[model samples]
Target: MSKTVFITGTSSGIGRETALYFSENRWNVIATMRHPESRKTGLEGRKNIDVIHLDVLDPDSIQQAVTHALTTYGSIDAVVNNAGYAAFGPFEASTPEAVRRQFHTNVEGLMDVTRALIPVFRRQGHGTIVNVTSMAGRMTFPLYSLYNSTKWAVEGFSEAVAFELRPFNIKVKIIEPGIINTSFYDRSKDVLSTKEITAYDTLVEKIIRYEEGNIKKGKFSPPSVVARTIYKAATDGSWKLRYHTGKYSGTILGLRRVLPERTFIGMMRYLTLR
Candidate 1:
């Protein structure tokens, strides 16, 4: 029997790419997204792939998606928790709803999905969980307070859970992608702003200009690179905890470990916000 993988946020970007990669590799893919109907063009009628509706914020949707996957594939070998969004800009500028939504979707949502799948994996005697965290989880940059916080939460959660799940024959993996060319750069990211407060306008403008300048010249990895890393994590059969993808992910993470805290902060500021 072919192994099966369930992936979230498969409407586009890394999620979509992962689905395609696994399908091409002959693994049955339960490709799910909030609006699967909109993605029918390239995905529908494809072999070994089933597009389903799954919104991480919706518990019922999560359960239904998992149930459908099990029913269709008989067993789910792994799950890729790639459903998340980013909120950028000053923390003070963010609305209460936006802040809640950020954690709810990124942190709480990931937990909910994992919680739902744990029982199935436990019953099966083995499974793999690949979380799509970010380089921001271990490091930080200006203008991404909420997004960084969420990814940091995921990093800690995945690391801690790996120890607990190992005895159950289940592995938890974290994929930290640095900067990838995806809709996350635009459509999938929420940029927060406070209309009434202009105090931080200059700082925000400077940061945006600096970041944009780099992006124009940035050598971003394609989403396919991340998909390959995820595939490796799923099939490697090792309890290895973290996998870094994208351009300079390994270099940046290495520097974070060797450099003093203040020195790393200074370097990041000079390179990004200066």
Candidate 2:
């Protein structure tokens, strides 16, 4: 029997590609998203894929999605937690509501889904959980403090869970991708400052201009690259805890490990500004 995988945020980007990649390879895919009736409707036509509704913020939706997957496939061999968004701006500019929303979707929502899956995996004696994090989790970037915080939380959560789940044969993996070509950048929410801090306006404007240029240039790796890496982590029995995808993800992470903090920060400042 072919193995089954449940992936969240399948409406676009990495999640969509991962679902398609696995389905093409003969794995049963439970592709889920917040709004299931949109352009992703055609995904249901795949030979072994089921597109379902899943709003990570809604516990009921999460439970329903899990139930449907379990009933259809009998077992969920892997789960790709890919439902998240980036909230970009200066930390001082971010409102409490914006910060809450970021954590709600990126951190709390992920844990909620993991909680719902733990018992099922335990019973089956094996499973894999892949959390889609980012290189920002390893190193900070200007104007992305809130987004980085959430990914930082994901990194810590995945690391801790890996140790806790090892005895149960439940493997946990973190896929840290560098700036991927995705709607994540284009569709990201920007929190505007309620009160202007004139001191940082120039810096903020420069960062915003840089972000817009990156989106227009579309220089990041294709989502398929991330999808392939996620597939390997889900299927390979190597037990690696983290997989870095995209051009600079691995190199940046490696530099953080070796370079002094001040030097690393200086290099990042120059790269982002220059």
Best by TM-score: 1
List RMSD in Å for every model shown: 1.1, 1.6
Residue pair clashes in candidate 2: none
Candidates in order have lDDT scores of 0.91, 0.89
Instruction: Report residue 160 deviation for candidate 1 (angstroms).
Output: 0.9
Q: Measured by TM-score, how close is model 2 to the native structure?
A: 0.95
TM-score of each: 0.97, 0.95
lDDT of model 1, residue 98: 98
lDDT tens digits, residues 155-264, model 1? Answer: 99999998899999999999999889888978988988657788888888897787577589877889999999999999998878999999989999999999999999
Best by lDDT, which number? 1
Global CA lDDT computed for model 2: 0.89
Candidate 1, 156: how far from true, in Å?
A: 0.7
